[model samples]
Target: MRMDEQFILRVPPSVAERINRLLSENASSSEDKSLDLEFSEDGRTGTFVIGNDRFPASVLDLPCVVESYKTYDDSALVKTADVGQMILVRESGEASPDVVEYRHGLTPPLRDARKRRFRREPDLNPELVQRDAGDENARNANKKAPPAAAAKPEVPDTGGNAGEPDGSDSDDSDDSM
Candidate 1:
């Protein structure tokens, strides 16, 4: 990581002294240790390197009280007992191989929306129930219908009684057959 991108951590003086003592002891050990420790110029931040794995200074300073370590397909998740935060480190060559931090594990804080529960009704023209008497179609209809035809008497049905069914029950039966 670039020097500008590195995070400058703030630690207590006693904790810093203890970390410095531990680093010196680890450095003078005859056995080849897997972890390589490095401190920042201000003596506040420390880096712990193990093989290809790298952790933040704040994360490395925590005591060895790990809650869990879950290995995924392309990443590893670490949960520490000191802080209730889940740290996710992705494998190399991945598109976004970065250390991600989560408060709980999965969910994040709620965000604001540009719009919410918005409704819109389409524009519509009113129904034309009444037509103007001076319209061309109205004038043409009045001209097409003569006054004599409009004054003609109404025709009635030939049933035996008004508003009743016909009494005839004639069925289709051929006498020649």
Candidate 2:
């Protein structure tokens, strides 16, 4: 599709309802009402955010333009189009109306990075894996025996006014009052 041309995206009824609700809520709350739609790096999944609420959504058929944008950079805001009204696809005999729109968002670089960083991968680091295995074996070997109690060090006694409750020197002979 041309850059200026608008495209349509099909979302579930729940998503459409959420969009409508967000639109209404934002319209009453602020003059700059906007529906922020962000998609995954793969463009397969997305989410709609308005104010503090977030609604997760999936794209049935992501357009090439969005995919192109995602490929261009780590962070991409593909396009901004006027969100059209929900319409029922009578030809397809679909029970729910689809949300028509041309705008979409991409997962931010930081978000994607964080996701990758936190994702579990046992074989990611062989050294770490080996260390963990060793630790497990050590724990299992020592399971039968209780750990020895550590002895507390005793403080040496110093005969002086160090333990005075006033915590001040008795030689307070100040001549310069």
Candidate 3:
């Protein structure tokens, strides 16, 4: 955070505002949000707290040693964030980098991997076909004979009294042999 040295940074106004709000809770006197940040020669950084605790931030810059043309993807931070207004320091690093909201969201666009999907054949199972054939033969053999009618389900009789007439214990007291 010195005057000359460059550094990486990620302090957009929105983020700074949030930090300012967090630091303003117990300001003894006023609700002020002014800040003065400074860094030491030994890389020790400090900030002057004014009305609140929030202060501006900037990151060290990263060196672009290995460079290449990204024919596939755009610059990593083209439109991911509203970072155009964020502070930048001489320390080499991108400021207010936009991180992906969800790691699995929006998979990088893919090429036509399977252009011949229409030409693909339907999946077949020889074992299933054999089982179907067996079922068909069984049905044909059973076609010669008719199935018997099913018996009706028995219903329990409930009389007005507690002891009801059960088939196992008949109430035919009048038919004494």
Models, CA RMSD each: 20.5, 17.7, 21.9
* Candidate structures ordered by TM-score, highest first: 2, 3, 1
Q: Best TM-score goes to which candidate?
A: 2
Q: 39 in model 2: Cα distance from truth in Å?
A: 1.6
Give the alpha carbon lDDT tens digit for every residue of 20-55 in model 3: 675766544435645556655633333334344544
Q: What does the lDDT come to for candidate 1?
A: 0.40
TM-score attained by model 1: 0.18
Candidate 2 ranges beyond 4 A from true positions? 9-18, 21-33, 62-177
Cα lDDT, all candidates:
0.40, 0.50, 0.42
In candidate 2, which residue pairs get closer than 3 Å at backbone N, Cα or C atoms, i.e. clash? Answer: none
lDDT per residue for candidate 1 within 79-141, as digits (tens), equals 422333322222233233222332122222212111222243555444432344347577787
Tens digits of per-residue lDDT for model 2, 27-99: 7665335667787796545565545655565444221123222234757666455433221112123332253
How much is 36 displaced in model 1, in angstroms?
4.6
| Model 2 error, position 26 (Å) | 7.9
Ranking by lDDT: 2, 3, 1
